[model samples]
Target chain A: MELLANLALGLETAVTPTNLLFCFAGVFLGTFVGVIPGVGPLAAISMLFPITFYLDPTAALIMLAGIYYGTTYGGSTASILLNIPGATSSAVTCLDGHPMAKQGRAGVALFMTTIASFVGGSFGIIILSLFSPLIAEYALTFGPAEYFALMVLGLIAASTISNASPSKGLAMVVFGMLFATVGTDSQSGVGRFTFGSMSLLEGFGISAMAMGLFGVGEILSSVGATRIAKIDSSSAKLLNMLPSKDDWRRSWLPGLRGSSIGSFIGALPGTGPSIAVFMAYAFEKRVSKTPERFGHGAIEGVVAPETANNAADQTAFIPTLTLGIPGSATMALMLGALMIHGIQPGPTLIVEQPSLFWGLVMSFWIGNLLLLILNLPLIGLWVRLLLIPYHYLYPAILVFLCIGAYSVRANPADVLIILGFGFVGYAMRLADLPAAPLLLGFVLGPLVETQFRRAMVLARGDFTDVVTRPIAGTVLALAAAILVWTLVSAIMRYRRGMKALTRNPTG
Target chain B: MLDRDYRDIVAGLGLTAIGAAAALYALFNYNLGTFTRMGPGMMPVSLGIILAVFGLLIAFPALSRSGDLPPLKIRPMIVMSISIFSFALMIESVGLVPAVFFTTVIATFSETRVPLVSALVLGAGMTLLTWSLFILGLGLPISSFDWPF
Candidate 1:
């Protein structure tokens, strides 16, 4: 009964004319960027931050959140049609989705992915609505020590779990932490690392840095390398889109299982849609009665990962909204957007701003519905979009990036920050270093530092006193265990490599 | 180019130098207070040391590995930087129109295939788009055109 009332309230807030329009607009633009191969939702959202400056917080968040989930729906289109993943999370879709396309099943694959995305996304929304309030209520009991320990666990897990080389990830995290220390220290009121520059006093603008790292950096990396393969639009006929009875029968169970896995993985800190989809794909492959059908045009392959991808995308918001802790880089960027609106997200956010929280949640359903309607009829249109020449597209994108950076503070100097970080991002790419951990580090660094300081003060400078608290102790122990395991595994891998080299000198 | 892959070694050394520089600067310029009454420099110092240690860890084992450094494209980097820098310089003085046009024109050179005429058309089109979208539609405060002294 309470859930219904809350949902009723959400519907009332979401159905406002202005909110509906922006939600449509967000999903539309999301599909546009998602259909294109080079651009990701991160860059798209950052570029739109300037536009959000003029809108109300609710509308801004509604639209941005729409784009967030909407991308997962569209990303599979490219993977299935062109064998080029529109987003990193959609890469696995390319494996079987492309094969399905080759078998004159492109229409069915596209249709199934959209249906699976809706199923997964709807499931995630249900989980979010049921779980967020409970999580927030539990989080209300957290003190500074518990918060610090949890953040430490988040950072360690993020670096070690995601990256192949744990040391490199840790190094990037530390680098970002060091970078976060550059501005005037709020606690001590002392300027550190400013070098007497006025711009350095406040440190870097999150929007500007995000644009540089994600937007410009992405353009720099892909502008020269990409060659869009010509897509065959005829295979995606409207009549061919309808799935046969067998296709429907194969899809339902995987869709259900994928939603469960996606929601569970998405709620956990230090994971995202990409990881969820991969896990779902592996699980599906292993469980299949005929495993050989997997790298071929297995309909289960298309359904499971697509379902998990959208489900994970929606549920990744759980930690971000409820605990004020971002589980992934994209969530961190969204939190940064909220901060720009002068809204500090914490346990009190839902209680204090019930309309905003519920309205945004409800908008996800509308956004997903809008995507289904839009994608079904507009398949031909998006394929045509892929045909646009690269040279013409990039310059226009560059203009938006420059203007977006400048619009953040109306400061031209911010544009230069994008330029600087563009180079840094490009360099990191060259060195094969992951930029996600760096971003997570930068955003969470200050928060972790503040919590640690407060915890220390409360414990009268005794580290053990702070760590020995039941919740903090358990969380910190988890962090330490992850670190030790990562180190041990890295050593074992190194020794195995050495033994391999010894066994075969020049084989 | 060296025969062996120095990618890890170079990257590790770069991180080590940056971390060392930050740590040394923090140590020299700021006070390191006690744990409870922590100073501003304390976090920086500790983070710097940790980064340096991580860097060494990355570099040491990489000594036995063989790989080649990935090629860095200079053309896109240089062109993109120049165009953005020009926009930054022009936007405040002349305003959004000229800044967009100027940046677009220069950015077009980043790709060898684009002809000169298309750059101008794109510049004009983009300027109008930004003008209508940002200034007219959104009511952003920036003027479409301006002249400063």
Candidate 2:
């Protein structure tokens, strides 16, 4: 009865013409950007960030939420149509989606993906509405110790999953933490690393850093490499948009499994859809009847990843909303957006602003439905969109990125910071360092510091009490275990490589 | 050429310098209070030390092994950087129109350029669109031409 009442409130807010219009605009722009190979939802969100400042917080969040899920479906479009995955989470789709496209099943892949994505997203939203309230209620019992430990676990997990090696990712995370400390320390009211620059007083602007790192950094990385893929637009006729009976039989079960995997992983801090899609693909491959048919135009391969990624994108909001701990960098961006509107996103948010929470939830359902309608009949339109060349596309991006960065405070310094980080991000990519961990670390740094300090005060300076507390101790233990495990694996790999070198000295 | 790469070594050294600078600044300028009443400097100081250690670990292995170094495309990097930095320079003093026009011109060199006539048209189109979006639609506090400077 309470669920129904809450949902009714949500619909009441969501069905307003303002929310509906922004939601459509968000998803439409998300798909357009997502279909472009180098641009992503991250870039699109930041580009649109300044515009959201002019909106009511509820509409702002509803639109951003729409963009997030819209990008997921759009990424699949690029993967299937052009064999060019827009984001890393969509990379696995290209393995089978491209092959399926080659087999002239582009329309069918689009059909299955839209249906599966809707199911996966709705599955996540249902779980989110059902579980987030309970999680928030339970999290109300947490103290500074528990929060601190959870942040540690989250940071480590985020860092480790970022790159092939743990140490490099850790280095980047630490660098981000250092950068986060650049402004005046909130606790002491003393600037640590501002170096007497007036513009450095507020540290880095979140939108500015995001745009520079993902938006401009991506452009820098992709400029040198030319993409060569062709899509036969003639193949996407209306008749081919129906899945065969065999395809349907194979898709439903995998979609269910993928949604479950995505929800579980997405609920966990620091892990996101990239890991979920990979795990889903690996699990489906392992459990398949014939593993040999896995990568070569398998319908299951396309279904599992698309379903998992969409589901994961939705469930990732669970941690961010309930605990104020973001599950991914994108969630961290949303958290920053919320803070900008004076809506703190911890446990109290649900009780304090039930309308905001429920309204956002309702917007997701309405937005997902809009996406399904948009994606199906408009498959041909998205294919035509691929004809816009990079030359025309990138200049528009540069102009918008500049405006987005400048409009943060209408300060020119923000643009300078964007330029600086754009270079930093490009350099990190060249050095094979994972960039996501840095964003997560930057977001979590101040929060972790405050929690740690508070926990110390509570413990009366006895650090031993931190280890004695059961929940905090367990969370910290888990973080330590992951750290030790990665270190051990790295050492083992090093030794094996050495052994191989010694055995084949001449070679 | 061994299996391991020296790319990590360079990255680590750069990180170590940054960490050391941060730690040294904090150690000198801020009070490191006891754990009971931790000062603001405690977090950055600790993070700096951790960064140095991770940097060492990352850089150490690379010292013993050789790795292939791909030629960095210095051209695109410089071109994009200059274009962006130029806009940063002009957005406030000279205004949005000139900033957009010039930056678009420079950024175009990073890839295949359209014809000169087409490039100017594209630039004009971008200026008009930006004027509509940022100036008209969003009401950012900037002018079409702040040209007295």
Instruction: Compare the candidates by lDDT and give the number of the best one.
Output: 1
Worst 10 residues of 1 chain A by lDDT: A498-507
Tens-digit lDDT track for model 2 on A32-137?
Answer: 7777766666666666666677678989888887787777788888888888877778889998888888889999998898998998899889989999899999
What TM-score, computed on C-alpha atoms, does each candidate reach? 0.97, 0.96
Positional deviation of residue A45's Cα in model 2 after best superposition, in angstroms: 3.0
Per-residue CA lDDT of candidate 1, range A1-507, in tens? 877888888889988999989888888877887776666667777777677777898888878877776665667887888887756678899999999999988989999988998899999999999999999999999999998998888888888886778999889988887878889887898998999998899998778877888788888888777585766677788888899999999999999989999999988888787788899999999999988999899999989998898888888888888888888878888888889887888889889988888888898888888888888888778878877877888888889999889888888889999999888888887787777788888899999989999999999899999878999999999999999999999888778767765686542
lDDT of each: 0.85, 0.84
> Residue B11 in model 1: shift from native, Å?
1.1
Per-residue lDDT of B1-149 in model 1, one digit per residue for the tens?
44334888888888998999999999999888989879888998999889988888887777655778887888998899899999999998999999999999999998788899988999999999989988898888888889888
lDDT of 2 at B31: 83
Error of 2 at A342 (Å): 2.1
Alpha carbon deviation, residue A25, candidate 1 (Å):
1.1
For the second chain, the TM-scores of the candidates in order are: 0.94, 0.83
Fnat, 2 decimals, each candidate: 0.75, 0.66
Clashes of each: 0, 0
DockQ score for model 2: 0.63
